[model samples]
Target chain A: MRISPTDVAQVMTLLHDDPEFRFLILSDLCGVDTGSVMQVVYHLWSDATPDWLRVIVDGLPREDPRAPSVTFLWNGAEWAEREAYDMFGIIFEGNRDLRRIYMPPDYQSFPLRKDFLLADDAARSPGQGVRHMEQTFQPAEYRRTPVLRQGLGSDAGHMAPGIQTAELASGEDPAR
Target chain B: MTTEQTVRSLDDPDLFVETPGTIYDAIPPLPPRTEREAEFYTMRDGEMLINLGPQHPSTHGVLRVVLKIDGERVVDLDPVLGYLHRGVEKICENGDWHHAISNCDPLEYIAAMFSEAMPVMVAEKLLDLGVPRRAEYIRVLAWELNRISSHALFVGWLALDLGGLTPILYGFIERDEIVEMLAALTGQRLLFNYLRIGGVNGDLNHDFLSRLGDWMGNALKRIEDQQKLLNSNEIFVARTRGLGVIDRDLARRTLLSGPVLRATGIPYDVRRAHPYSVYPELEFTIPTREEGDSYARYLLHLDEIKQSIHIIDQVLHRMPDGPVMAKVPRLMRVPPGRAYVSIESPRGQYSAYGMSDGSDQPFRLRIHDPSFFNLQAVGLLMPGNLVADTMAIMASVDPIMGGVDK
Candidate 1:
């Protein structure tokens, strides 16, 4: 079932405290980043009953994503909330230690965000294509010629200055 | 520039001493607001800090816990994790259904079959597909075998942590035998990517079955021998019994699962609670103990091994001969929906939550690892216990950092 960010704490209380629901365990608390919004998913399972309840708090604003913390109800939510905060930047309100769980505390970006680019991607210049092939074939002839860089060009035989390219011990073609 | 100036500079308090108005000086002191916070902030005379591993052997893996000890008794503990995080959840979201199975293999490396089974089951549920009867039986067989190996290692590791070496050696003997059997069936011993989308990758051959039967005959007796070796030992009983006790309420509140939860007198087994695959068809009982201590948890592991063996034997008896896999498309495009599938893993309830947007890849994949939850109880179990008892408590919890950090 889907609930609003405002209703998360109350519903969690009802699910946990109410005798009928009795969802004693907070199995998982994960965050999903859609293009426009963040969805904090809570999976609750009961010890006495077989019911697995999913409480999804959808439509948290993208720029400032925040959800009410359920740590007070379930201490296990502490780490799970920290993990969500670390990965998706969804702040869990009322969580005392809302620091990063998977990433370093000083880490600036949430890697799980859809728009977050990896540090490796920042190294490439505009129009600088992929460095490695997505998938390589066994045959060398079918392989695409790698784009050479300035200061390290084809004239250098793809070797940087001061580095020598050795011939194969068999004295065969380098490609072979 | 001169020798006199150099001597003067070296002696100067201004040059030698750290400045008062630096970054460290700019921070304001925190005043405790709550009664509990006040106690934590105030350091009693005997209280001192001990940082135990992101590298300690007793910690099992790369887990660091900052423990505040009041002499021999632990006053507080703060477990620091994420040393082994590899962004597994994000990787699962980016990868296709087939890739997700292989990616999740390392989460619970001790029982690779259970870890693999969770994702496959969730994907199957999301796709609304039923596995073949033969495949379900094969999955049960593999899962039970993996559980035995995992529990065997735990038995050894727990004993080793408590300063016993022979049990771990015996544990490894059983584990190696099962792993060899698994390798013959799955090709990989440690991280077996055997479970596919709708079914398993391979069928159980005659050789594998015969060997499994061979192992089964002596497996319980061997485990019993292991129990007798440790359970009756005066030191083992003294170290484990009445130490690191977790009551039934605390166990449920902390969300401890699997054998640890069962040890607290709650017979909540996911296999029985939410029956999946061929488990519902199989006949096995959930064992519970009222002791709720380290010894009870150890006994629970032995009992569980027996129960798992029973389940596997039942699978062998009702083994069906047919196609192993249900017909699945090459590119499995799971329908837009959400599903959570959990199984009774070695440590606890290992669950996989998947959300699909009608794409070949999952929109989001969340692994609700049991170790991650069970590790939380350490905070409750550590305080007021002897400093040495911390190792015993953590061992009883039996967290796999691969699953905890992931």
Candidate 2:
């Protein structure tokens, strides 16, 4: 079931209170950054349902995503919401203890956001001047040795031996 | 300037101001960032704050708890987490589907089989893959053995934390045997990345079977001996009985599963509640205790060991012969979809939610670790207990910090 951010608290309350759909256990609550939008996903388990019922609070904007907290329904949601906030920067409104759970309190950027590039990913792009070590620095001498060139070789040592030192020095990939 | 004038000038606000310390401060007096922290930091007339651990031995791992106490009794506690956080979810999203399984291995380091299994099962679901019967049986066998080892350590640690030492020695003996058997099967002892997306990595071999058969014959007897040592010990019972009681409603509300929830008499085991991975085909029982105290949780672990042994025996008897590894592409990309898979780990329900965007890598992989949620109960259970009983309560909950901080 997909719910709007505003309807999260109300819909979750209904699921918890209704005898027919008593999803008493909030099996999981997590934030997902799908590149297009931020989503708060809730997994609820109940005897009533054979499998887990997934409720996604979809279409929260990437910037300053806010969703109602379900801590009142199930207190276990507290840490889960904190983790989501810590990783994805989605504020779970009404969670009294809404602080960073896994990240340091002073962490500036949400690590799990789509836009948050990992150090290596941020350092170089596909066609940029910066190249991966394997792409640029295959040793010219190591390639000359036959036994070392074929089987027991590091990733950087596996390039074609025919490529000249000048090509390797210029960081030009003959394979590409 | 003269020495006296230099000292005075250095002390002057205009000349030199005090710099606030960073997080590394021995005792950071920084302002509280949240409501709970502010409440726990504030001291009443007779109350004082005691920092339990980011380093205490009984904390199991690097878990810090700020305890507000009035004399010997704990008024409140705020557990400060993130000491073991490795940004596992983000790392999983950055890697491909296959790498996610191995990356998850360290989440529940104690029982890594379940941690690895979660991602594999979720990826299988997303890919709509069917594992062979022999492979499923192998997976279940590995998981049950891992469960026994985890529970054995839990028994030992709980006893050790409460000041008894003998039971842990016995606990380690039993754990070592099973772990050695697993090492023969999985190639690594602790972080066994055995479960592949479609099936397990290797087939059961002669060495693994012989070791398992040898252990199986004596496993029950060994556990019974350990039980004899601690089950009726006056000191163990005195400390654990009626301590850190979590009622059924609270257990449900807190989403406690496995033995802790079972100890509360709910009997909500993931294997039976939401059956997965050939568990529905297997035979076993969900053990429960109505007392819901620390002792009940302790006894539940012993009872669970017996049940796991039973499951293993059944698996061996029903073991099928076939190729273990399924045919999967070297570079696999799952269809764009979302999948949530939960399994009954020794601690509780270890689950994973995998979202694939028709790419080799997952868009997001959320791991719902049992220890993370189980640790939350510490904050709920600690208040109103004596300061000394903190380790006792925490041990019974058995929250592995790797999982909690992940």
Chain B structural similarity (TM-score) per candidate = 0.91, 0.95
In candidate 2 the C-alpha lDDT for residue B78 amounts to 77
Q: What does DockQ give for each predicted structure? A: 0.12, 0.17
Per-residue lDDT tens digits for candidate 2, residues B1-406, read 1222223455567543334344533323334445554444434466666788899999999998878789999998878899988888878887888898899999899999999887799889999998999999999999999999999999999999999898889889988998999999999999999999889999998999999989998899998988889888999999999999999999988878889999999979999999998899999999999999999999999999999999999999999998787889999989999999999999999898988899899888889898988899888998999888999999999999999998
Q: Which pairs, if any, clash in model 1?
A: none
Residue B75, model 2, lDDT:
94
Error of 1 at B281 (Å): 0.6
Instruction: Report the number of the highest-lDDT candidate.
Output: 2
List residue ranges in candidate 2 displaced over 4 A.
A123-176, B1-19, B24-29
Measured with C-alpha atoms, the lDDT of residue A146 in candidate 1 is 28
Give residue B384's error in model 2 in angstroms. Answer: 1.6
Interface C-alpha RMSD per candidate, 1 decimal = 24.4, 24.1
Residue B202 of model 1 has an lDDT of 94
Residues forming the 10-long window of minimal summed lDDT in candidate 1 chain A: A141-150
